[model samples]
Target chain A: MANHTSTQASFENQTTWAGGRSPFNVSYGKLMMWIFLLSDAFTFSTLLVQYGTQRFSNVVTPITTKWPDPASIFNHFPFMHGLHLPLLFVSVMTFILILSSVTMVLAVEAGHRKSKSEVARYMIYTIIGGIAFLSCQAWEWYTFIHEGARLDGNTFGITKQGYDHLHSVGFGDHFEWADGDRTFGPVPFAALFFIVTGFHGFHVFSGVVINVVVYIMTVRGVFERRGHYEMIEKAGLYWHFVDLVWVFVFTFFYLI
Target chain B: MEFYNKPGDYDAINYIPHTESHGTKELWKTFWLLLGITVLDFVIYFVMPASGWRNFIFIFFGLVKAYYIVGAFMHLKHEKINLALVILVPMVFVLGLISGLLYEGSALEVMKSM
Candidate 1:
């Protein structure tokens, strides 16, 4: 322990840090959070990049079959089923996430002011927004599995539905799964959707849980006693990162 | 002050960031800006077919949205240069990865053409 401390001190002395608690004027906790989030960013970027690679690579859209378009898959909205609105519900879900990011920022601001009630309010709103986004994703996933009728399709597609109404109207019989030489995977499209969106949905679930735990702690006066609401700020960082990743996912997976 | 106070301190508030009271106005502004951009993104997608230019604009707006969230909401714009670079520098590698993927993907497309 003594040698470790001396070596750490020697390293600090070798640098211009001067042995202060924070090396970059940022608290140790916040800096560590940023570094962790940076690594997580790389993970997501790699996932999406691989998605792009697999999507464009090895995709031969024969006249008899075309890859599944996102707009056609996500067209169904609640109670307005048959409207053929392209990307409407997905856009709504995106805005819900963005709105949650806003609430999280407000919660961080309130934390800066050391206003407990304000923090609780904003945190609750943010949590609610997170839940709403999760609900939307669940519905989207359900619709995908139900409509595509791929029971053992991918690792993520769990449920199955008999009827696919979109097939009756939009791009009828667009996939020739029997042609092994043409399609990328047995069902590459479904596989990619399940992997990318399922991973993102998992992140949302964790973020919501983190927010709830932090909200409870805020209500319990943990940060108030600790002299700062930095935990809330950290949570806000994670929530915003989730939103940021979703923005890229929407563009790459849905639109482009 | 609560953590560093040497007993009998005058300030009662246990604040961390000695903020200058800018309030949440900027948060609201960024929210509106992001919302407007999102709506515009969808509208652009709706109005325009998925052409080269359309895809470029879609990715451009996505990048802008990412910047807004990181800069405004996460307060990276206000942080130190080292911390900001710590996050941004790794992102360039992501760009590299995407470029490489694009090349490989286009190669596949070319093969399909052939």
Candidate 2:
């Protein structure tokens, strides 16, 4: 007991709150961000799992109009209209996002070196990459609404034809499906597509907003004044997580 | 009061925070590996015949990319084990949810047959 008293006194010099400088010496904010991201990951995982369940269970015997093929649905690139570039534009978008991640890491690295300009430069590049990715998403959504494969009148939303009938018969506005032909399949597939991808798009949009705010802060010398760029590093963690989720979405939705 | 780190020498920066700088070499290494994996995924999708194994390959490559992003880009590889577990443990639940639903789906299919 006498010997333990000396060790207890030694810890008195250490902050009682930290209990020896945090487990793994992790910063409070970063740890909290990680926890938040973990929760977010679970949310996304559930959506995707549910999507998989519905899709595979609905696989039919004839296979004429199964679930929509993503490769065909998302095969357009900007300015190359009507071209059949399967997964190329999406791949470009993926690479852009990955490139932004690399730039973010550079920004964090520069921050470590206390190079304000370097951090700002890399941060600007990262923000631009985010904007590019958002633009791609917009193009994708536009193409989906106007040109991508549709289920038409299928009960399960499985048919990929009938767009020509819509145009030839002056069914311009209501291309989704005619009520008379609704027995082919239901509309769950399109609804699910919008829900899942819309959810992901919303995340990316929010991430871009966060990145813009952080970019403004970086340019304004806030981190430099604080003498640490951990702020940018924290933002980088979030950006990377967004990119990571996209990796899964791209595979499950498009490539696979 | 806000805590801020003092600036370190350019060369010494990586050593000061006990956190390695995301050096260009390390960043590019991961970037190339991830890019290559994605390209391979596309190739396999195009060249290979559709089968049960194809989906598994896609998942395998996807997992590899996820590991890299988490480890290198997110810097979790360098983080303490306690901190890493903060994310890893919950992921078990995610996996459970996925596998459980898949099993349930198969069970339902069997029921339909019977």
Candidate 3:
């Protein structure tokens, strides 16, 4: 009995040593998630700050300056033209993302309960939600590209000039006036729009991939062997982070 | 040492994992809260004036919604208070940075207009 007790104690000590000590007593995965989120927060902050600066500087431009209203800019379908629908597509995208976040939370809940089927069901729903968001983003991008917003010379009519030009150029020069109708060329605004939204879309894409992997593992009962769905909880954290970023985007980019 | 192998040791280390059914209730509550805040956001957008009172209202509601989403949905509320502070402090700094940038940009605009 003594030898057996000693052996168990030794094993426990070795296990503790191998695991290393956490400063906050949190799990390794959770700690890493926090760190990753902190860095991501910085990236988003910089993007928003820069966007605000540019927007504020442009606001002083004269009313004649043709800054593309987001409503007009985003309202339309790619290839299937003349839809003239404002924010309809984006609204659908937002709904999908938000719904997916809900499903992800459910999945995390199922994992906590150790219900394999429930967890798998919710995970699949989350994956579909993610895919829907990506599809909407793709359409948004395509519509943006098709609109012919030029990244080069005064194409679409929005100029990056400061307030000084507001008096001289007015808002009309801000928009492209050609062939008796105002048209936009693909230029700086388009470029910036693509870069920011594209980056966000990529994050969504990555999130979908992560969800799919987790879904497959859950279906295969991998997490069951471990007796928990901690992995799902971790992935849910990431999904929520993406959703939080979109809240800021909706406010700053779309509404503001 | 002896406590480590006690019958309730596992329970001590791990939170009493709420059942999936309980989690569903939590999820629904979160969804409703989010919707409420979104409605409030739209109200602030349209109903409030652009300056002074409106601006204050918008910012206040925005922060409230942000906190709700982050705190409840993101599980920051379940985390240690210190950890929550770590995340929130940086966000506050970001807001300050945004305000500073807006101010500077406006200043430059005024200068050029002059």
Candidate of highest lDDT: 1
Candidate 2 segments exceeding 4 Å error: A1-20, A148-186, B2-22, B106-114
Q: What is the C-alpha RMSD of each candidate to the true structure, in Å?
A: 6.8, 6.9, 6.7
Supply DockQ values for each candidate.
Answer: 0.41, 0.39, 0.29
Candidate 2 lDDT over A4-28, as tens digits, reads 5455455445663556335545666
Per-candidate TM equals 0.83, 0.81, 0.78
Give the backbone clash total of model 3: 22
- The docking category that best describes candidate 3 is acceptable
Interface root-mean-square deviation (Å) of every model: 5.2, 5.5, 5.2
> What's the distance in Å from true for residue A46, model 3?
0.8
Candidate 3 per-residue lDDT, tens place, A40-145, comes to 9899888878776765565524533344445445655445455445445565566677789899988887787788999899989988898888887887776566
Model 3 preserves the real interface contacts to a fraction of 0.30
Kindly give the stretch of ten consecutive residues in candidate 3 chain A with the minimal lDDT sum.
Answer: A163-172
DockQ-derived CAPRI band for the predicted complex in model 2:
acceptable
Of 2 and 3, the candidate ranking higher by lDDT: 2
TM-score of 3: 0.78
